[model samples]
Target chain A: MSERGLLIVLSGPSGVGKGTVRKAIFDSEENDFQYSISMTTRKMREGEVEGVDYYFRTKEEFEAMIEAGEMLEYAQYVGNYYGTPLSYVNQTLDKGKDVFLEIEVQGAEQVKEQVPDGVFIFLTPPDLAELKSRIVGRGTDDHEVIEERMRVAREEIEMMALYDYAVVNDEVPLAVKRIKEIIASEHFRVDRVIGNYIKMLKEM
Target chain B: MSERGLLIVLSGPSGVGKGTVRKAIFDSEENDFQYSISMTTRKMREGEVEGVDYYFRTKEEFEAMIEAGEMLEYAQYVGNYYGTPLSYVNQTLDKGKDVFLEIEVQGAEQVKEQVPDGVFIFLTPPDLAELKSRIVGRGTDDHEVIEERMRVAREEIEMMALYDYAVVNDEVPLAVKRIKEIIASEHFRVDRVIGNYIKMLKEM
Candidate 1:
């Protein structure tokens, strides 16, 4: 019997390198996972492609989708809307491909509520000092902005207790490897795999 | 803060290659895990080393340990005693090392009941046919013995629902690699790691 795909929700503090880790996972040949392209009302920046990087939408369209119950989980951040499309995620899983959603903590909890079987993985820096250093190393934000982000990070770390597993982003390759393993192991979960086997046997 | 070691329980039906997978994990340089040696009243087999393989004790001594509340979990099988010592396991975890325990389904359940925090991993053959092939592949068991083992295997598969995760032991190295990943990912669990940071902040 063929197995279904896993819905994996990945979350972390802002400076925890979730984006970098996600890119590494995508680069790895061992994993055949699909990343859910989110719908957002935010104006697309340079190099961001519509439908590839994100499903960019007008505020009206985003609100309509939300009203139609099309979004699995959505949130508004600084006057911009971002949410996952339930149909797209379900389609991917139905095709026996895992769907990875890189989301924030609140969005992760919402996805977990909607898809109780989805796997939640939280990424973290080695520690606070390292997280601060990484934030400063990027040179993208001023000290005030970094301080605000770190405060938010502290709050997010507290919510890490809600995640099913944690991956420390001490080393890039190692974190990506660990994430790939988690996906592989979850695929072999007895309830998901053996249940299908038993059903197939009964049909025979 | 130093991370604590994970308590990993590995179990599977007889001849599903749980032993082989465990050995492969031990051989890996990435895994610095210690295999928990069980205390047993069963007579030592050929090439078995005391303390290294198992702690061979007299029936009276085994019972005394049980009575003293030193045993983590214990069970009787084929008129022989087998049990885990809590002190040894605790000491290993205290030293920030993960401990792997290979036991039967019954013993795995007992260990889970005692230590609810322990991670349970079940290994299975790819299919019933593969299970039989592997059982017969051993070149020791006769047809009747093989058939009986298959029957027991079905019973074991039925209990797969109780396990948190399962790995099909179709390929030994792949299965071991998945197990190693499970251990590594488990270390990232937010409940175990983030609470201390939050607690330390509150105290400050």
Candidate 2:
């Protein structure tokens, strides 16, 4: 195996079971896979652990990090700051762990500007009805909110073409299996293995 | 699952166990995979099947096929005319079966020109010593032939960057697993699945 670890940016529509699939993977034998905990200005809800849930920061602190170019991508959604920390990504990768990032399409696009070759995977619901039902089943949002979410999700899905792989989240285990396959094959990429293979050939 | 099947081209150096790994894939429960039997003008060696091994053709037959553009790529190797039949690939893929083409790097390059999106995977030995031992283990070739093979192997391996994926044949099971992943991921490619996803979204 190569010393370098994969940086996987996993994105999809809001209703897609990104978190469920992410947990399914980590819950497997792959304990070495690192999760990128984003820094956010959103107030920590009840039972939410600080570091595990998010690195809760104030607006000023998050802005300062942005000013220093430490944040890979930061966006204000519903007046709350959420950003992927570049330091965390670099430090995790340096530790030789495959880092998984679950983010929205916009944040993924921003991260792509910095990490061009990062494995971008888009998880999708089996169909629009499944997506709608999943969102409605949450019961946290009203009809108006659900409708708005549906509209935004269609736009988000339109950007699926930008991703390298798109797995349908019909079943949790199946989705996790596809993701594992992606990570496995990514290591065999020519750009990643060419240098080491060439060095060994020269030594021989 | 997507209706369209994948077009996979597996290539590697001569000493690398490309044939072994390919057989291992088809031997599995993956009956949907179709292996391309090349048409050749070479005299059938002992124990070689007619169509299963290679489509035995006369020089005139092979030349006429080339003139008719029936051959996707034809190469004269050691006074033997070998070529991949374009119609075979299209017919197999049209029937919703993944087509596997095991070819040399030169022939792979030619096929890529016709099937631009074909998944090109390169298999390699873990190290030069292993590759050399594999070559020497085959008592068929002389020292001069073995040395020339080594040189050509290195040259071919250098073209790894042209491939979409590269798997080191350290273990048969592991290599087959990686290739399976590559095939799985290739099907999940945005170009292949996005159209269906979009259609479902519109229907919703």
Candidate 3:
């Protein structure tokens, strides 16, 4: 039997640049893991590909998937549904292909509940002040909205205790390098690689 | 207080090239961890440095250290005592410098009991056949001795389950790369890095 692939979940506060880091990781030449396309009811932003960035779906279609238990993890954000599709993740992993998921903290929590063995990474800004600046610089949220995001970001940083690794997203390249190292090192973890050795011992 | 450094223990069966991999790691430009010097009762061989290779000592001095609990982990092999000095390890780690210990599996087991938090790595040959060949290539043992060594090596591989990571020493450079990645990734583990975040929360 083939070894099972890792389920890598990258998550953090709303404005921690999870999407940007995920893009950098995918764009890197060393990337061997497959990206798990999330299905969302949110409008496609400029230059966002239909299936690459997200599997854009209508609210009705998304709700049907949720009803049919097709969604791996889902959450409502800013009046839109966002989630990973279940079958693709399962199938890819079963085929020994690592699946990468960049999702919100709430969705990550749900994924943790369902698949506790996944490598859950919390991408945090260098500090609270930096996190606030990133949120404000987005230019999308108003003053009150930005303040609320900072408050929520603070809470999310506290939730980092639940993650396996907390990577400071101080620089995109450095964060990418650290994430790659985490994935490479995790593959050698004894629990994940012991089965083959056990079988070898039995054969001996 | 500074963050305590990691105690990285690298071990495997005899002739698995543990020393070679450890040397390559130290020689690398990225190596920031401190090598923990071991005190041993063995006679210094040709070209081996007194304080660099090991702190060679009389059998009496080695026994005295063991009696005083100054040795982190010690074992008698080939009628000689080899062990890590507890004080140096503690002092270096307290100063936030990582301490690396490359020792036999027997000594590694002792360290596990005392420093369960240490990152225990098991370096293995690509396969049992490769392991046998490596031992045979050493040319120090006869056929019967080689067979006995293989038996012991098999048992050691069974002990891989106790280690945190199992790295295949298929190539020296590859093994070195994997070990470096393990150390880098370990630093980011939530349990190790969470204190700062928790402090930040308290301050906020």
Candidate 4:
């Protein structure tokens, strides 16, 4: 059977080390997965590139795309539209490369309805204590903000049931290894094979 | 969350080399996996151990186990009783070890109903021609027997959709690699996590 690309939705609560685990996988020579570049009306922060970090767009441009149903999922945050555009993900998949969309849990829920076959993964810390420690370790936020992040994390953990796989970020290397295996094994899923192989076998 | 064991069911068409792949994994030192030793009333072949090859039993003994619901799945084949005993599989799982059951498609189906959580895998030959060649290469079966085996293989391939994953036995190493990944990735399944972690998070 011919190979097809996978749309992987990587999400987690705040301070779950999602970025670190994803970075390790992307840097490896295994699959060379493409990260979906999001579009945002928010101002680009320091060291952020126009296309590499995000497709910085005007409010009018973002609104037109939303009106045309071009965005896969979008939301208004702090008076700016932040959303994932579908074209880039489609183009990468057409070329037979997997796309990793690192989104929040709510955004991931939206993408699931649109791409039901996408592999949704939830990253998790080892425990609530570890999650709290990670947030405190960031060393920027004060006690009240850290407490708020902890509360939000507890709520997000409840939504882990919606994901297809839940990889614990206990160790970065181990978590990345498991994610790679998940991608490799998912390629041989029976649903995909039934769709393509039943006809091929009949011809045989 | 605490770790639990996995029940892995491996099956394939006659010439797809299921034995070779399962042997590779069982012999590996990475994970201590237990092979579910089957019970058979058939006479032991040369070089076959009572427990290793099978828990050789008399017809009365096998039937007694079946009556007691001790046999996971049993069938009378060629005037002999053959079946998997549930005690061995459950004991291995209780000790936190993965259990591998290599059986035919129908046996796998029976086991699926009994233990619905098994990771059922169908190992496929690269193509029908390759499968025919493998059967002939063994040089034991005559032309008529080989032809009948091929017919059975076709029927078995049609049932592959009932499996959770299908790995093409194009090459032994590649197929074994895929199966290993399947085992590793299954540990992170969200359904298993949801069963345990939901309560753990609630406690926090």
Q: What is the C-alpha RMSD of each candidate to the true structure, in Å?
A: 5.5, 5.8, 5.7, 5.4
What is the C-alpha local distance difference test score of each model?
0.81, 0.82, 0.86, 0.82
Candidate 2: tens digits of C-alpha lDDT, residues A1-204? 335777999988887888888888889885567999989999999999989989999999999999999998878999999999999899888777889998888898998889988899998777642554555667888789877866866776777878888888888988898899888888888888777656655554
Error of 3 at B15 (Å): 0.6
Residue-by-residue lDDT tens digits, candidate 3, B74-104: 8888998888999999999989989999998
* Residue B131 C-alpha lDDT in model 3: 53
Model 3: lDDT equals 0.86
Which 10-residue span in candidate 4 chain B carries the lowest summed lDDT? Answer: B128-137
Give per-residue CA lDDT, model 1, range B1-204, as digits (tens).
666788999998777887888888888887788899999999999999999989999999989999998998888999999989989999999998989998888888888888888888988767653553455668787789877765665676676767877777778887887788777767766677776666544543
Output the number of the DockQ-best candidate: 3
Candidate 2: Cα lDDT at A102: 88
Model 4 DockQ, alpha carbons vs. true complex: 0.47
DockQ score for candidate 1 = 0.44
Chain A fold similarity by TM-score, each prediction: 0.84, 0.81, 0.80, 0.81
Query: What DockQ class does candidate 4 belong to?
Result: acceptable
Q: What interface RMSD does candidate 3 have?
A: 4.5
By lDDT rank, best first, the candidates go: 3, 2, 4, 1
Model 4 lDDT at residue A20: 88
